[model samples]
Target: MFSTLNWFGWALLSALFAALTAIFAKLGVAQINSDLATLIRTAIVFVLLCLYVAGTRQWSNPLALSGHSWLFLGLSGLATGASWLCYFRALQLGNAAQVAPIDKFSLVLVVIFAVLFLGERPSLREWCGIALIAGGVMVLAFKEQG
Candidate 1:
């Protein structure tokens, strides 16, 4: 599926999914605690991912990955777990409308990291997007005057 679109399209789709998640989670978390909510969501995702891999028979290709691949995959899992932990804590502390915008600010971090570590150069358009994202996060952090 990801093979079909360009990077811009993929980024847009990811942003849309993130926004949908924030909206749904904000509604759902109003009734349930974040830990329980995280557990339930993680369980559902685990089942779905397991079934998808099983259906695709990707489990049979274990030797295709190198040791370095496994190492990176493990690190990726750790990063994901940390992100989930912090995200739930943020949701518990504030409205998702506010939290989600701050979370979206990670793109600016990504831009910095990519330039430093990956030696990837962002185009002018991407810089514009990052600037707008930073501005949005600043606006989200401030209280609305009456």
Candidate 2:
């Protein structure tokens, strides 16, 4: 099942797991500090990835990676950590439905950032979809006053 899977398949699986992460994290953080919850979640991810890499015989020397690879990956790791911390804190205080949609606002940012930093271009159609996602997130994030 995994052999023929492509990026979309992997992305779908990631989305499923991310949904579960919101539900689980909301419950897990109910009695614990959000920071500590993030720590535990990060540790689990670290261990799981380590084991998966080793089991798949994909381990490579850190020294073998290029400076560019190391720099970008390090920056990505820092951003992921910060995102997780904020996400967990938000989930702790907000409804999962609201928080998750707001968290997914990153998708809109990704498109803009990719165009600006990575020189990727999106078509008019793609921009329309991104705009819809942004609109949806805004709708989910803002509640009407009584």
Candidate 3:
């Protein structure tokens, strides 16, 4: 099943799950401190991923990985943790509709960071779509609540 799809399929699934996460986390944060809630969420993800890797026989020696891989993956993990913590806190204090779109402002940042740091060159069409995302987020951020 997983073999049939390429990146776009996986990205669509990720977006669906992420939307659910915002809704669920908002409800969960109501019952506990946001920081503690993030910790608990992180723990669940860790254990589930462990089981998934073990069940799939995908485990390998971490020491076998290159220093660059370790460095980048470690930094990515830190970034993910920070993002989750902040996302949970935002859900605790704001409407999911608003917070989720603003959170997606990261999409614009990703495109810019890719150009500057990763030497990526998105086509004009891609730039237009990215601009739309940025504009949509701004609209969501500033729209009057009637």
Candidate 4:
């Protein structure tokens, strides 16, 4: 059923949710410590994902996963936790408008990593898009002092 949707469609949904996450997280962290807020948010995500897997009857698949999958998934989880910690702290200290765009500068890094590690070949147009994203990040992250 999901085969009809391409990567761009799924990525668009991810981007939309990411934008909402920053807004909600900023509001949530306003009265609390950002680290505590991230903990709560992570707990919520953990429960929701558990429920999703159980509801989908996907519980049995984990045992079938290879060692490599487990290792990489664990690393990914660690990366996510670190990112959330930093992101929440950044949001606490800065405007969401400024912080979110800078956070998304990861896109430029993703393009480079994909090429270097994944051995994926991107076309000239994709490289240009990555450059544009980098430029936009620089423009957005720059603050002019009066």
Candidate 5:
């Protein structure tokens, strides 16, 4: 079913879901502890993912995973947890419009990390786009103080 869609299509869907997540999370976090909110969200995600893996019969034994895979995946989970905590706190303390854009500054960092760590070379056009995104994040994240 997904064969016809390319990476860009998937990325667009991700962007749509991410935008919805920000709006929904902002509303949900109101009048609650941000950390508790994040925990609830994480629990929901964990259950859903577990169901998905079970339904798909894609569960792999932990022992089957290589050490490198375990290490990297563990690190990724830690990073995700930290990111979610920070994102939820930011949402609680700020407007979704501002917080989401600042969170998206990750795009710039991803580009740089891809080049340096993954040895993936982006074209000059892509670099320009990255720079533009960074600039836009700065513009969106900062407001003039009266």
Candidate 6:
């Protein structure tokens, strides 16, 4: 399903989701502890994922996955859970506006990891975009100062 779209569309959608999530989460965390808020959000996502799995009946295909695939999936899920915990904790202690920009820096880290682990070298155009992204992030991070 994901293969049809060009990678740019995927990146755009992911960025849009991240932007909106920061805004909504900030509003949500204002009235609750980050942990509780994270729990609520996770519960909702879990329900949605479960529904999707049931609807697709993919839940019955567990045997199709190789042991290595299952191990990677489990690790990826654990990492995502850990990330949500840290994100909520940060939002609880700081403004979402601030946290979001810092969190966005993960893109830079991801580029580095891609080079190291995936052996994917970015083209010049991609590097320019990354530079622009970094500049934009810096601007957001300092928005309150000016």
Give the number of the best model, judged by lDDT. Answer: 2
Order of candidate numbers by TM-score, starting with the best: 2, 3, 5, 4, 1, 6
TM-score of candidate 6 on Cα atoms, chains taken together: 0.81
- lDDT for 84 in candidate 3 is 94
lDDT of 2 by residue, 34-140 (tens): 99999999999999999999999999999999999999999999999999999999999999999999999999999999999999999999999999999999999
Error of 1 at 38 (Å): 1.6
lDDT of 1 by residue, 48-114 (tens): 9999999987786767789999998989888877787678768877888789878878889989999
Top TM-score model: 2
lDDT of 5 by residue, 1-146 (tens): 56698999999989999999999999999989999999999999999999999998989898999999999999999999999999999999999989999999999999899989999999999999999999999899888799
Worst 10 residues of 3 by lDDT: 136-145
Cα deviation of 79, candidate 5, in Å = 0.4
lDDT of 3 by residue, 1-146 (tens): 98799999999999999999999999999979999999999999999999999999999999999999999999999999999999999999999998999999999999999999999999999999999999999999776869
Least accurate 10 contiguous residues by lDDT in model 4: 1-10
Residue 112, candidate 3: Cα error in Å is 0.3
lDDT of prediction 4 = 0.93
Across 1-146, the per-residue lDDT of candidate 4 in tens digits comes to 55587999898889999999999999999999999999999999999999999998878868789999999999999999999999999999999989999999999888889999999999999999999999998888878789
Clashing pairs in 1: none
Identify the runs in model 4 with alpha carbons over 4 angstroms from their true place.
1-4
> What is the lDDT, from 0 to 100, of the residue 7 in candidate 2?
98
Evaluated against the true structure, the overall lDDT of model 1 is: 0.84
Question: Which structure is stronger by lDDT: 5 or 6?
Answer: 5
Stretches of candidate 2 off by over 4 Å are: none
The residue pairs found clashing in candidate 5 are: none
Candidate 3 local distance difference test against the native:
0.95
Ten consecutive residues with minimal summed lDDT in candidate 2? 136-145
Candidate 4: count of backbone clashes, pairs at least 3 residues apart or interchain: 0
